[model samples]
Target: MTDRRGVVAKRAEDLMPGVPYVRGWNRARQSASALADQLVLLGLDSDFPGLVADVNVVGDGLVQLGTVRPEAAELLATLIAAGLRAELHGTTAETPATARREAPAA
Candidate 1:
C-alpha cells in the first residue's frame, strides 16, 4: 500500500480536470497591481472577472485566470497570440484559489 500523502504533487492542470487554464502578464516592468489596472483601463475588468470567477496575481508580474466560458477562453488565446502573453489550460473544476488554498503546506 502507498501512503497517500507521499504521492507526488500534481500540477494545477493535473488536479483541475476539464478546467480551462488562463494566464496573463504585463510585458513592461510593472507590478501585478499595475497590470490589473491596465485591465480595468482596457475595460476588461468588468467582464473578465465574472467570466473567469477568479483572477489571481502571481508574483509581481503574472496573473492567472480561473474558470471561463468558451468565448472568453478563445479571447484569451487570441490575446496570447496577439502579444498579451496569456496562457490557457482548458477548463476549471473549481476556483483556482480554492485549489491552491487546499494544497498541502510544504
Candidate 2:
C-alpha cells in the first residue's frame, strides 16, 4: 500500500503543472470539493469512468486528479469544458494569479 501511494505521489507530482490552474479555478468560484465532484461526474459520464477515482484536494487548494491514465487528454478536455483553465502537462506555466485574473467571475 505504501509503495502504491509513493507511486501515486510521483504521478501526482508529474501532473502538478495543472495545479495552479485548478487552484485558481477554485478561488474564482468553486471550492476544491466542488471541483472534485465535477471531476467525478465527468469521469462517470465519459468513456473512462474509473480514470478519476482518487481526486484529492491538497495544500492550498491544489487539486490532485490521481495518477496518469489512458484518458488523460480526454480528461483535460473535459476539465477545460467545465471551466478549468488547464493545459497538457508541460504546455502551461500559468500561475494561480494569472488564472484567477483570467477566470470568469462566478
> Which stretches in model 1 have alpha-carbon errors above 4 Å?
1-31, 50-63, 84-106
Supply candidate 2's per-residue lDDT for 93. 48
Query: Tens digits of per-residue lDDT for model 2 on 1-106?
Result: 1245553222223344445535544452345356556555544324333333222223132333444454554445544644433344435545434433454443
Against the true structure, whose lDDT is highest? 2
Off by over 4 Å in 2: 1-30, 45-59, 78-106
Maximum-TM-score candidate: 1
Per candidate, the number of residue pairs that clash is: 7, 0
In candidate 1, what are the lDDT values of residues 1-106, reduced to their tens digit?
1138844222332324343334322332244456457556544455456322222222122233445656555544444443432225443343334433443442
**Each prediction's whole-model lDDT (CA):** 0.40, 0.42
| Pairs in clash, predicted candidate 2 | none
